[model samples]
Target: MPVTRANAMSKENKKVAVIGAGIIGMAVASCLQRDGHDIFVVDPNEPGLGASFGNAGVFGTSSVAPMSMPGAIRQVPKWLSDPYGPLAVRWSYLPFIAGWLARYIAAGRPDRVERQARALRDMLGRAVDNLAPLVEAAEATAVFHRNGSLFIYRSAEGFAKDRQTWDLRARNGVQWEELDAAALRQFEPSLSSNCTYGILVRTNGHTSNPHALVTCLAQNLIKRGATIHRTAAIGFVLDGDRLRAIRTTQGEIPVDAAVVAAGAFSRPLSRQLGDRLPLETERGYHIMISDPEVRPKVPIADQEAKFVATPMDTGLRLAGTVELAGLNAPPNWERSRILLHQARGLFPALRDNYPEDRLSLWMGHRPSLPDSLPVIDRSKRSPDVFYAFGHGHVGMASSGMTGMVLADLIAGRRPTIDITPFRANRFA
Candidate 1:
């Protein structure tokens, strides 16, 4: 497999079309624009309002653990039975998701899990550091902060069960501190008494407002003279093995190269380029309380509850959960409600209710591959087409690195990091 440099597909003064206005697309556009390329962003939805708007906002530098791990298969039955559990699969959609599910479970094999973790470490270990320059350039330093993040366990047994995961994180060079009950209280006094153990990752950080960060990036890119088209990309116009233009709802727009970064909607578009990726939407839910009584000092994740409560600029956001329902299915707001319910256990003083206008319930699709890796390679069918979707739970965490590597690829330069694990045709 020979690497296709951007110069081989197009000249240096290239016009690149980025299909998506979310974090991934906007980041890619900003990097390209900085590299002196013409950038046009396409998206029918408002920029940053999808999953980017509602994530927990944690810049998880130590998030090297795969969601599918040893014994994960045994927990599936419990997740299926419990309506408010962290994972859910709509029975009607099981057949549609069965194949991906099989691959997901298989990825949990011990050897495969270790390989995935190593790849994640290389890809995400510097997430916050990689995004710092971009944050400064966008004048979004206020929105990005490094207060660190905490993972609390309710009992010794629970913490012990995850020893393997902790070991893997250590192997990946993740820095962490173990805290007992008294220390946990000193770190976050608002935490419930049930949280007896804690692991603090000082390298982790989060955004004050996830949506604002992305919007700021887009605004900064526009101010830099990047063109943005508020329309959906329907397909691509190709000349032999090269992409000639993108056919959007608005009209055909010529381009030198194109990238599919449309989040969950990227699957169909990638198939247009002949990459049959096993992409699935992991529908995530979030509940925001604008006037919460108690706010955690930083982001806090309850090991048992499987939700993360982060203090945002506007309010406290409780976000987590994985639902496997196709793209067109209506949101199950009940999942958001479950987040609220479990969040109260983490912060005992949280109010039971808030003004209807002060609370927001949101559900967005997270584009995920079975092995929890994103495709960041040029298309096998056409080097003029590239992929940068399927970051799954870490899209926000890994967006900056993804953009940097993408820009490097587009500039006909090898990425500083080896991206073989993220090849677009790995499923082949």
Candidate 2:
């Protein structure tokens, strides 16, 4: 496959080390490779086994609304009170996260939310288009489905409550159609009749298998002369604001430039580069049911329950939830159980109990920021060192564009979108 230079600037190629093998890291590598850069990826774990492996897989182009929307704080107290609620926080971790919570709440102010939404729209709106080239290169185009997604509500009141969010999406050029009970049922017969309202974002799409998609891209990179280092990136060896090489557990690997796409583990590396970002882990969980009796035709998000039921090649994936328990906390299986209970309610045909072999549960940390935006900028200390983490919940959907933008920055070309909102020093 010939690399496309339409988005490339100078033909100069350099040794680029992408730190992290998740979807974001691989996507960045793919774009850099497309621009003819010598690329290598670094990670300790198997590629794509982190949050990218277990996300809902929705392209979520319409998901421009920041997580910290207006009136979101009022519901936090109620959400915290419920153990099985969509949001949870380990009480012990609250003190450590208090400052982040404050900033999160402040980000919800109407003015800030508007700016955040526009920025998110610019990046996520072209998700599928941006990812098309990489998907083609990987020969995994079949892994993606453009059948659209549903946001169904159990009651008219619940639907009305989200009007502002829908309005925000509309203002950001997101196209969606309102569906009543009959229409919702006709669109997704597998859903329970309790869902009375829905909004179909026809422009959105989803990956049938996120892990496979990322692995294919990684494999493609390797086939194209890129290397994958199965080791942890500990630090960097710098020479007066220029990255000389990356320090790893195994030893140092010389590189002309580096990217910190390490997801939840990127904070310390950023701090090492003189950028103290307020990056936190929003621990998310998912349950996969293999050979489900019933599955939605497309991804369906229960607006009130705050989880998504996505039909995947492996089976049906019920994924969503925000648990702020930090990165080191043990897995909370109870949260996975809550998803099972919610799934039964969403899909009445699903069995109350499934054999352990038929079910798989996962918990991974989503690298999140208070304002629900990612840091896709060069380091304050070195232009060669770029930051591309803190994507929060939309990493899979936004990875393609993030990669293109990073490649443009690295190649000294203008990014296709405005990246000011994603600057590392925004919090400062």
For each of the candidates, give the backbone clash count. 0, 0
Residue 313 lDDT (model 2):
96
Over 4 Å off in model 1, which ranges? Answer: 1-10
Candidate 2 vs. true structure, TM-score: 0.97
Candidate 1 structure quality by residue, lDDT tens digits, 138-174: 9999999887899989977899988888998999899
Question: Model 2: how far is 56 from its true place, Å?
Answer: 0.6
Index of the highest-lDDT prediction: 2
lDDT values for all models: 0.89, 0.91
lDDT of 2 by residue, 156-268 (tens): 89988998998998899999898999998888888888988888988888999999999999999999989898899999989998877888988888878899999999999
